[model samples]
Target: MSTALKSIRSIAPLLDRVLVQRIKAETKTAGGIFLPESAVKELNEAKVLAVGPGGFNKDGQRMEPSVKPGDKVLVPQYGGSPIKVGEEEYSLFRDHELLAKINE
Candidate 1:
């Protein structure tokens, strides 16, 4: 297995879900003033790191997740469960939580 697959396998996102790492908000302005956490808007942009096998549909068939690992996505402001992985914070949510895939 590739190193990327190994790292993703270690995580094993559950129930046809995925884990997303949120992009941290910029703290410094163009003027060089540092902004506090409270001053920053809640960020909905994230990068997909791990994904589960597709969820089962009503017919018991699997439906694949549209977003894949490494895809940048837009999530709802309050969706997903918050988790701390190593020293970084991330959110684990079902594929349904994703609002859109960001285009380059």
Candidate 2:
């Protein structure tokens, strides 16, 4: 399938889960100085790009996730599994790992 189709398919069944693509941090300081990778810290905010089917409850019912694609979310700095899609880096985590929905 095409890349666009694949991305769409990945989100179709997302009942409560979400797929996020992290935003790259600024490489330059406010003073226009360049910062190295080691000097930078991981950011907790990200852009939602895909979602999964809702999670299962104790009774087998599906629990819906609150966020959706295109939403900016706050995630744990150290959580989530890293994934590489094509030439880009992405991360996949359960809905629980997302700490909050950032309002913008």
Candidate 3:
């Protein structure tokens, strides 16, 4: 984790909420050509930074989170509240808001 992320420890996620940072879009092409800012598309991929313990069920049982910190996950194109910390950008999403986890 980067230094900027270290500060995120102070902002803990409550219930099933999760903190994530979106993966940056590639600015270069396979042929080594550089793409302008407007040419790059924002990816819907993000890295899980922090996760809440679990949400309580109807019976009061804790429900485990489907994803954890350090996991790369797919997020929806819309939704999620944008958060800006220093020069980095982050988002808050419910555990169920995540689409899927990426392996490798």
Candidate 4:
């Protein structure tokens, strides 16, 4: 397996938690001009790497997660725990904290 994949799999997200990798900003504009790293905007978009088995409800029932691995999703500008493994960066957010899922 790829190092990144292996790194992500090393840690399983706890109940309702989702592992995500932020999608990078475009380095080039629509006009095709190359932009420096500083000129690029940071997007809040991310792709789900892994999801927890679901958290327990007040009645102690298991609540299934809304998202699954490989789903492109929207994340909040704040919150979520940051993690780094083998030189790669990742974030962990709760299922409710995830803003939305990207259809594309």
Query: Per-residue lDDT for 12-97 in model 3, tens only?
Result: 88899999999998899999899998999999999999999878999999999999999999999999877777677889898999
Clashes of 3: 0
Cα distance off (Å), candidate 1, residue 60: 1.2
| Total residue pair clashes for candidate 2 | 8
What TM-score would every model get versus the actual structure? 0.83, 0.77, 0.87, 0.88
Q: Give the deviation of candidate 4 from the true structure as CA RMSD.
A: 3.5
How much lDDT does each candidate structure score? 0.81, 0.74, 0.88, 0.90
Instruction: Indicate which candidate wins on lDDT.
Output: 4
Q: How does candidate 1 fare on TM-score?
A: 0.83
- Model 2 misplacement above 4 A: 1-16
RMSD values for the candidates in order, in angstroms, are: 5.0, 3.7, 3.5, 3.5
Task: Kindly give the number of clashing pairs for every candidate.
Answer: 0, 8, 0, 0
lDDT pick, better of 2 and 3: 3
lDDT of 2 by residue, 20-80 (tens): 8788788899999999989877777899888887898999998888778799998887867
CA error at residue 86 for candidate 4, angstroms: 2.3
Please report how far candidate 1 places residue 4 from its true position, in Å: 21
Show pairs that collide, candidate 4: none
Cα deviation in Å at residue 43, candidate 2? 1.1
Give one digit per residue, the lDDT tens place, for model 1 in 47-68.
9998888899999998898889
